[model samples]
Target: MNIPTRSAIFLSLLFHRTVLSLQPPAPRAIVVGAGPVGIAASLVLASRHGYDVTLLESSPETSIQTKYDPTKAFLYNVNARGQTLTKMFPNLHDKLVKRSVESKGFADATITVVPADPNLPIPKSSKLEKSFEMRNNENNEAGNAMPKSEKAVGVGYWIPRHEMVGLMVECIDEHNEKGEGGKISFYTGKECTSVSPRDVGGVFVEVYQADLVVGADGMNSKVRECLSHPRSAVGGWSLDCPKPNYFKLKKWRSPASFLRIKVLQLPPQFEIPDAEGNPPLITNSENIYAIRSIYKGPRNYLSLGLLPMKNNTAVRATNIVTRPDHEVWKLKDGNAIQTWFEKAFPRMNFNGMISNEEWDRFARAEGTRFPHCQYSRGMAVWDENGDSGVALVGDAIHAFPPDIGQGVNAGLMDVVCLDRALSGLDTVTGKEAKSAKENDKPSLGKNLARYQKQHSPEIASLIRLARFGAPYQYRQPHRADRILRTLWTLNVAMRLILNKITFNLVPPTCIILSQRPELTFRQVMRKADLTTLFLKVVVFGLIGLRFRPRLEILSMLKP
Candidate 1:
């Protein structure tokens, strides 16, 4: 009994060694979808936020190939809404900018408002599109209602998606190596069917349970399928006339759809100024620019944007044709490919730019296509399914027309916001050291709820803008909406009137947005939605008058 007191001290020391040496393993995170978004998410979480991550991707060969493939890779535009990474990930941003063609001085997007009549001649001169000097040099110099882009030095940047992807992967890897033993693993060719939901805040991803399952897995996500309601609808997939549900429930619809897209890679010579013995420039501006055309038909329209590739090796153009998916199958033959290109794009010729064999490759190859709008942004960030913490980011939560250039941007933005949301997360172990109870993990409910509340508005805005601007931006407007075209004629007339009144010598035509990086999709979308009837009438009238960009014409009318 007198010797017993020493025994208690030995037991205490034994317990300390056992618990301290084997502390709960760091919370494990599984990221599905190894695209730029998913990779970015994994990088941010591991290198910056310090989370163990395993990234899984479905496509092995397809996603990595960025060669001059008509079917696989296409050009991408990064706008003000997407330029936030410049500050957050400066190294990554700088790397991407270096690989991308500069859109400020060397190249910018020229929104050409062209008359749909095939007979109309496309003006080849660059002077027709106004310049920043021209905008400010007006006699009146009234800047009252002008969009800020007119005053800025640049619009945005364009990079081929594949090249961007490669650069991003490189950046992530380089940065991650410096991390202090951060667990980051990536696997390709893993098409996850369905994952078993865990109880304590992780999922049994093919038997290896993780602490969190993030579905960065695009529109048609099986992880989304796991969280979504069995019977549901989202975007064009559920075009049923009745109301099944809105954002309240998990809704998965039919296979998502996309316009039969035809992408082309032209010789660098394609962008040479036509005024300098070249072909037609999209705008009248003398600066090298990416051309965005809003070709207006009687009832339908098409929005085409083309940009120069890195080192000026090639020019890339994307043609979004609204055809039945079944009809626009793979390339039939070289003649068919040539005929299709000639028919879809009558203005540009690829004869010398691309050989017949190349054209066939362009037409025949199956390119990357996204869903029209497949999965709902439904389900909670951390809901009690079997018992895991499941969340979705990127196209899984919000993907639609892709008009606002929000696909990659939205996903990147989501990662930043989510990281902020889970800043002080406790990283409670799900089942390794705790009870099998769902409540065993530290509460992440409020943190997740706050994330959903704060982020959903932007995503909602994304959906709203995408759908509303779809017809106007590219597809066909309604018969009633077409009346606005007559009004656009008045809009052009007003620009001419103001230019005359102000004693400005510049030609008065339609004006396009400067594609300013500071210009938010929400702001632009709101203005487009609430535009006065008279203004719409004027803007539409200008289009009827063959005035291209309504923004410039409207600014001229600003008192």
Candidate 2:
């Protein structure tokens, strides 16, 4: 028999008979952590696939019951990639947007490339103008072709992390209310101590026992450690992976990821009219301004961040300081439980720009910190026999610097890929009774390995993109070399290039499209366009970087 024919026959025979007798009668899953990724995973497994899921959370019950704060927002830009996944899951996008601030297009902002010099006043204009002009031209073309109504194609939503969490919680509740085939039970304030895999079968996890476990947990994941070390007596695995020394030779990889912010002093209502005659609108109580100034002095313009640093931690928190004057006071209680703003601004003088009342009100409204402010990229995955049933999505897999605004978008794409993979299996198995029987055999190891292999490369690329983008977008003059300093005004161009490269490189599975069956092909083309645009921008940006002169303007600007 021919090889193809023989393979087909083998497949048919395998489908007819169960490949492994170790299959469980009913598949039950436990997801650790109640963060966005964990919640998303639970919803997909339970709501879509009808799998029984139990989510374990370490927080206390009271905390879960409280309303979300807008101040502690996770600024998200749901790119086409992530949106595609959201489309797959019903009502997720709408709910997320409703509670979050949406950005229709890139915000008008500037980045100063020169190192901050305290002795010198911050420059009024840098290379930002040229960057803006270039971006404007691109926007004009894209805008003309896009419909007026749809022109608001979401770059993404600036949403509070807690808000997203609340929405996920609501969705889970709704699913349970609908009398769905599967159910989700959330255990709050309960922590998982350890997990041990059974020699005969499934893993046995010991949590608070008061609560159950479902999906993988966050940073402090007990299940993950257990799975990584099946032979360990104590449940927790050694941080090191159990593999050949050759595997140890594998290089550590960093992906492109960052959090970018456009900061401007709240211009006075009267002075809001700029040279362009465009008046800054008051969306809320605080006045908005469109000023682009570069920080040049002893202090650095931007700081690199990973996890939220504690008060004593050396890693400085970006955007705002740790302590501010304003505090939140509830009407019923004379005592104030929550403080509005934490840190004071030491460098930029607000002196006359802000009124005491305005500051107070601003403090009352925003509570000190900015909302929708963090971003990251990359997801975590592990390899086992070229397949990885265990994989991470969203913040769990890859957390990036918030500069590029791709954190949530990247995570959402992860969902899309994962869902698609799972759905494909479901579709194939459902079509034939023999196939369904065969599918009943679960290879946890194989699936986890596949998840890791498929996701790692993409995650690595994103991390690199983010790292490159963060310095440019934030214009951390301290980190810039001599060449970048000379052309400080051209920093925006650098950002545009970085944006293009990262976006273009993003995989197609990440972009969201209208679910209309007929439009599927068009969606694919749109993804291609996004990718092409990114590549072109990246190539041009690099060229621009190389050709831009370092001496001409520096001589003129020297005081």
Question: lDDT per residue, candidate 1, 88-185, as tens digits?
Answer: 67877887777776555223333333322344544422322343223235323222122222322344566777777787777667766766645688
CA lDDT scores, all candidates in order: 0.53, 0.43
The TM-score that candidate 2 achieves is 0.54
On residues 77-162, what C-alpha lDDT tens digit does candidate 2 reach at each position? 45554666666567787886665544444332233321122233322332334434443363342211211111224454555466
* Range of the 10 consecutive residues with the lowest summed lDDT in candidate 1: 235-244
Global Cα RMSD, each model: 12.1, 15.2
The window of 10 residues in a row where model 2 has the poorest summed lDDT is 334-343
Model 2 residue 392 CA deviation (Å) reads 2.8
Separate clash counts for every candidate? 29, 63
Candidate 1 segments whose C-alpha is farther than 4 A from its true place: 1-20, 62-69, 104-155, 229-258, 268-305, 314-331, 339-351, 363-375, 383-388, 424-442, 475-559
